[model samples]
Target: MAKRISQDQIAKELGVSQSLVSLVLNGRREGVAEESYKMIWAAALKQGYVPRGGMHPMHAPDVQHSYVGVVMRAGLALAAQSNTFSHVSHGLFTALQHLNISLAFLGGEGDLDETKLFEVVSRRDPLLGIVILGEVKEPFMQALGELELKLVSVYASSPGLCHSIVPNDKQSVEQLVDHLVALGHTRFAWLGGNAKLGRNRLRLAALKERLAARDLLLDDRYVVNAEGAERQDGFDCAAELMRRAEGQNMPTAWVCHNGLIARGGLQFAYLRGIKVPGEISIAAVDRTRACTEIHPYLTSAASDPELIGAEAAKLLRSQPEEIGQWNKMFIDLVAPSLFEAGETSATRPE
Candidate 1:
């Protein structure tokens, strides 16, 4: 068999002392500079240095003693099963795997039963941390707080409840508006869903703010509210907008809530014989695979669910002391969104 990689070799590669490498590998990160700690870990992973216990140094040296728990709120599970959320879960899973951490899906049922959650976690024996994938009611949050585990929440934010990682929806809306404005489209319509959903509200507010910054106004006549963010919502909303525009001048472009809505709107526009980007431009806020599945790739602001998931996992593994400092502090950890230009958006028609 090939020779196994050693901490000494890892230290040499990272230009740090062997003892420093040992400290990091052993999870004794006290007093180690963050940069050096990361460098040592990276080198160890790159060199394939398996510690004496058959675990990578990044893994808490006690191999079988600790496990991370993922708690999915029933409402969140529906979204989690979506293509975007699948990517997010994949990122979280991959990150934990690299750390040699096993994950337990504590609650099989989507409902957030405090008793069941408590029972599931209580049986996990020395649970390292918990990652909540969606919003939980106050009672549920209180139940989680009682557990006193290092907790990281994804896609949902509750003050003083847990560390949160969410997509920058406001920033995404701003980028989408900027893109459409630059393409010379002045009149715009927002195709969105329930205002009760925090993300939908944030996106709408951001869209108005961006439009106002450019001296453009979102007239009440141009806004269409659907039941939800599903594809059918998009289709219905698009049809409603078409009816509303029957006699009045049609908006030059439409900004959809997500790829599903975008697809539905695109389908409606095609069936109505409206030339995409020829007669009207279309854009959206998400970059899921559905964006490309449509006829003309959608012009959208994309949020990387995988990146957010990985970051959430990283927060879960952080020192308890660090997380303690964040408790009661309403911190918004927002990830940036990327804008991808596609055929659906173009200069305003003359």
Candidate 2:
């Protein structure tokens, strides 16, 4: 058998640091220049380096054959068609691909059967870890705890259960409220999702706290529950507000639950010949691509689903080697969202 070429040999041939060679071999090229990456691959090929795990020779031997399992809760899978969850999945997949790690998607639409999940994960032979997306029920979580596998949670968290990655919804709402208040808009109307949902409840509570600091309050009369965070729900709520404005004063600004609601509200306002920011300015608590792609770009506090996904991947990849330590490890990671002042928001009109 031919002598195996080591990473050190490749590094020497390319005249780059061994660390850089290791990163390239490990398929982590986030900060690596394209030119350098190409040279490294070329050098590895010429040196006849055999990567472990039966993957391409350029991949590191340790990870080439490893796999990670992504378990999406039934509820989240049902809503996976939506852009938000899809973006998160996309980011996760992208990172795994770059790492040259195979992925096994086990649960979706089945409520995550514990026995089946265990079987699927164990079948991987060389499974590196598992990532759970969305709210996983307690029973399922308990089942997972018995697995002795590295676990990472995304979009939901259970204290001392596993590492969690989620968006900073509270801060996002705070920033949006501050922007609206600075615009001299005192009277406010909230168009939000079902109040029972934890995320929506957090945003609502943050809004109230920020308003209270300014000696203002969110009028119950103006508050509308969308029930579902859909465009139609937003349109209906806006129509109701318009009707109420006929008999009483209207809020100077409308803070929507998300971009979809803002779009729906803007559509209704346009059809009614109500000028946006002229009659009523509009903003949203959650931002997505829809905000920027639509006309009159929505001013919104946007959370990057991709960033959340990437963070989850990072946490999983950097797990301690000892699976036992994961059970004792408690990680609460929050990725902050940014506010974009698009064309829709403006100073209060005189």
Candidate 3:
């Protein structure tokens, strides 16, 4: 094994005190000047000073050394199973590879709390930037903003904090509404509008606006706010609405928040002996691999996870000064497409 590098050596190289170098390497940033913190990390990385028993951040075993950190909402096992997360990862990795910057995966929700996460990024490695995969708590996000690293978020945004890349909800809502309206459907209902996520809230608001533009109204009784954005949440919402609509007129068409929720709507249909597209039509706002996992493929609007990921990576690759200019946030929007040929939706019943 090659000989280890020391804080003494790094401090000497940078003309800084060994004590200051030690403090910065240990992730301390309270009183130390920002310039000194940056310098200490730069010198440590340049001199190949890996912490004892810790893998070198730039020269870890089996993979190229990394300078970019990827923080996800869930662990890799769960994320890999999600089409949206997987596609986003694929796009991010591809772009990072092209830029010749290796990626360091920070622990997910189960592995670390916000405090631990903050410590790791500030101390563990000389990471110059970070790529957040999905929504995070505002306090945690604000904490991250205080770090001296470039930050980019995929699927979410925080003004004055970091650049964000997200799908075009307005265009997506238009496609879904237009397709269903063209099919002769008049009465409509919304399913699985989880209010916790900003994107979900945005979609719901856009749906109402789109319906209003066409001189249609989404009945307050038919709009179900999901408890969570899971398939089971979709099923529960559908069941409640179905029960309430007994001996009453049910909406001829339903718009779901996501493919999983749409699948749950289908499940409720299966359980209740309802004929899809013949008795009622079901569609979703976002497309995913889940759309085709069941008997009849779900028709939905498609967001480009890959494009969002790539754009976020591109933002992080640019200089911090270039990204953080004029107090203007970068809200990059990628337009969505429609999967209108699926069997879930059809012309309104006579």
Candidate 4:
């Protein structure tokens, strides 16, 4: 067999410093010129060299030639089928397609079980990485850390496990506050179940902080953080808010936690003969497209799900090169595209 080319040989041949060659080979050319990056890419492809492990057992198939992998998740990537599902998973899938990574679904045992989920990716070697799309628990995430499998998380984030792709709730929440406030709506009701879930709690806290900054309070009576964001939670929460008329006996607005909750809030308002935006304007954090299906579409400060999928996928793909490197590239904020004019805005109700 012919002698293999070393990094030194490639550096010498390219007439560039080793660091520059390394950066180009590893696809980190932030400051470097595009031409040099392309030159290294072309040479590396031609030489059949992958900056990622080339001969290690953990090494995946040549992404340059052919790479195959599966998209394992605790639940089906239903966002692909219907916008009714979480848009987050769809974001991860979209990213995979762009990366040219073959994506497949291997649904787990349904409880966010780690072993079953990992098994889905355990097979099909030469897989670039596995994108576990949603509802995975921390234990399972920890296990993935041990597998040396390149991984990306869409709905959740963990430091020791893998790369993550999440939406920017801060901006989304703050923008929502601004939008609602602009409509001349001051008295607000937040209807959603409360839980110990980290992300959900973050949303609630963010809402409180955002509102407080404007001298607004969530008014505990209007906010039902007792139940989770389940459909029943939404319905009950809405029902409770109306029953008590907590803030002003006749509140001017309602802001829900999500589309599902909005559905419940809408239903509660309609059956009770309250006209949306007429008697009580409503808005919430809705990313899924289901909001439009409702007669009076919900106004949501929603994040883009497709972008979330792609960013997560991109991060997962980077895990291999970044294995020995301690630094992590966290992508928790997929810029959201909030829509205010979508069928659910009007001057604060009389």
RMSD to truth, every model: 14.1, 13.7, 7.2, 13.2
Backbone collision tally, model 1: 1
- For model 2, the run of ten residues with the poorest summed lDDT: 74-83
Regions of model 4 farther than 4 Å from truth: 1-86, 98-100, 109-118, 193-196, 226-232, 246-248, 319-334
Full ranking by lDDT: 1, 2, 3, 4
Listed in order, each prediction's TM-score against the native is: 0.77, 0.76, 0.76, 0.70
Q: CA lDDT of 270 in candidate 1?
A: 87
lDDT, candidate 4, at 336: 63
Model 1 residue pairs with clashes: 74-110
What TM-score does structure 2 among the candidates reach?
Answer: 0.76
Per-residue lDDT of 1-350 in model 1, one digit per residue for the tens? 87899888887776778999888878887899888887887677656566676533334545544578777755544443245666677788888887667777776225657767656554424677887776556677778877767778887887777888888888888888998888898889999864456778778888898999999999888788886677778899999998888888799889998888888898898899999989998898886787787469999896788898889888877775765564554355888999888889988988
What C-alpha lDDT, on a 0 to 100 scale, does residue 303 get in candidate 2? 71
TM-score of decoy 3: 0.76
Instruction: Give lDDT per model, in order.
Output: 0.78, 0.78, 0.76, 0.65
For candidate 4, what is the lDDT? 0.65
Candidate 2 lDDT tens digits, 1-350: 89998888898877889889889877887999988887887687667676655754335456555678788765554353344666777788788788877677776635567767656654425677888877767778878877877788887887788888888887788788889889998988888864556767777777888889989999887888777776887898898877776767788889888887888899999999988978788998765676877679988885788888887778778847633367887688888989988778788877
Clashing pairs in 2: 52-61
RMSD of 1: 14.1
What is the total number of backbone clashes in candidate 2? 1
